[model samples]
Target: MPDQPFSLDQLRIVLIGTSHPGNIGAVARAMKNMGLADLALVAPRCEVQTSESISRASGADALLVGSSLHESLDDAVADATLVVGASARSRTLPWPMISPRQLGAALPAELSRPEARVALVFGREDAGLTNAELQRCHRHVHIPTNTEFSSLNLAAAVQVLSYECRLAWLDAGDTAPARQTAMAKGTAPAGEAPFGEAPFGVEWDNPPASHADLERYFAHLERVLVAIGFHDPERPRQLMARLRRLYLRARPDSLEISILRGILTAIEKHTGRR
Candidate 1:
């Protein structure tokens, strides 16, 4: 099969509750630099298109003219196929939750699709997105940052995200093209399939896991497996592979994964396994 045709310009980045005209201008500049010109503003708290904003926009003034202004999120995302909410809080409401890097990895697939319109929604710098506002999204995201204080300025967030989008779409010329199956000559099966699907059906070798809580979950799992004789010192590695397969096959979603970890603890104590 032929590779899919991807166009980065199809992606749109939307901002909500933006408080500074200067930031709005900077965001326009950011989007332009990334080859993504579709920008939408939802109820900006500051005056837009001001001289300051235009000055910051530099040559990206065309984006300012093309940008849409709305009074609500519903209007802002009216035509979006994928909605990516940007925030530093994890527990926010939304669908398709992910981090900046996760979003970064998946954006190309979306932007590549014909007529696809992806939106990166940013909230106010003062309070970020409220739970209700985030719930409207198909997914939520948190930009990885200092745990002690995980906050980002509105314009800065736009800059970082747009930068990544630019690298994904425009950086194609900088490196050698990847040798996908279709790109290679002759008929041959790639060994990647096996590595892609471990013992179970873990489609992704390193599917997103809760890094903050995974260590503790793994420790509990190991302890229980040890008590149940599922994991023995002689062949602990083999047993772990099975457990890995189970998790992979299940493809436990973010919430389901959390529940599974909890169930593991209960099973350990109930069966006297750990």
Candidate 2:
């Protein structure tokens, strides 16, 4: 028997600082159309349940009604295991960037872990996510558009990513069963891989760290660095940002995070700063 199709229940569409109520409704519609249910709103600038929003939502009012609202992005995605932000512009500090198609291809394996919760974060209508916001994401996704008119609507962006996610889900459903059956019968080829394997065929010994876990680790790291005089908050030079990029790229698991935190504690004790 093949593995079950990835569940959209674990995938959340997060909109941050949305200024328009209609855009929120439209986003809800797009998510519902793609069979995605979890919608998180962070610091929405407009009233969530307005006539404009309901009108634009069409028949996706349920999503709007059930959406979770947060005061900050951190609270919105605190439990997510994978957080990917949609960025339209380039920054001085480049993040791990991937195309929309690549994001779709990667979802099946990412959502395979039972505890995994993936957050696809979108920014405001007028401007995108801030540098600080993008830094919090594990990866950044960009949708290539005609340079002549690259201004994609907020809801349209959500629709594009939502469609890609649906496509990946459908594709996984089509292939997973047959692959699992072959493996169960022991007729699979000598190194025949199963569906839903981790990206690049790497198997994890421990589950990936949650967003909260990474946040704690980052705080501990900065504290330890400051204690050792390696980082100076007064005259900082993007040291913490660079270090965050490095650790996020590593995608350390829970055990690794514990070990890293232990080292930080040891350093604090040695420096008598604890």
Which candidate has the highest lDDT of all? 2
| lDDT for model 2 | 0.88
Write candidate 1's Cα lDDT for 1-274 as tens digits. 2233346666778888888888888888877777778888889898888998999888888888888889888677755656667867656212355767666656544444354466788988788887656645555667777899767767678878777766655543232244343245433334333212321122442323332233345567777777876778786555554454355333343455577788987897799764
How well does each candidate superpose onto the true structure, as a TM-score?
Answer: 0.61, 0.93
- The Cα RMSD of model 1 versus the native structure comes to 12.4
> Looking at model 1, which ten-residue stretch has the lowest summed lDDT?
193-202
Where in model 2 is the C-alpha error above 4 Å? 1-3, 185-203
- Residue-level lDDT tens digits of model 2 in 1-274: 2445679898999999999999999999999999999999999998999999999999998999999999999999999988999999999998999999989988877888777899999999988999999999999999999988999999999999999998888888888877677767766555532233443334667878899999999999998888888999998799999998998888888899999999999888888999
- Model 1: which residue pairs collide? 6-112, 95-138, 95-139
Per-candidate local distance difference test: 0.65, 0.88
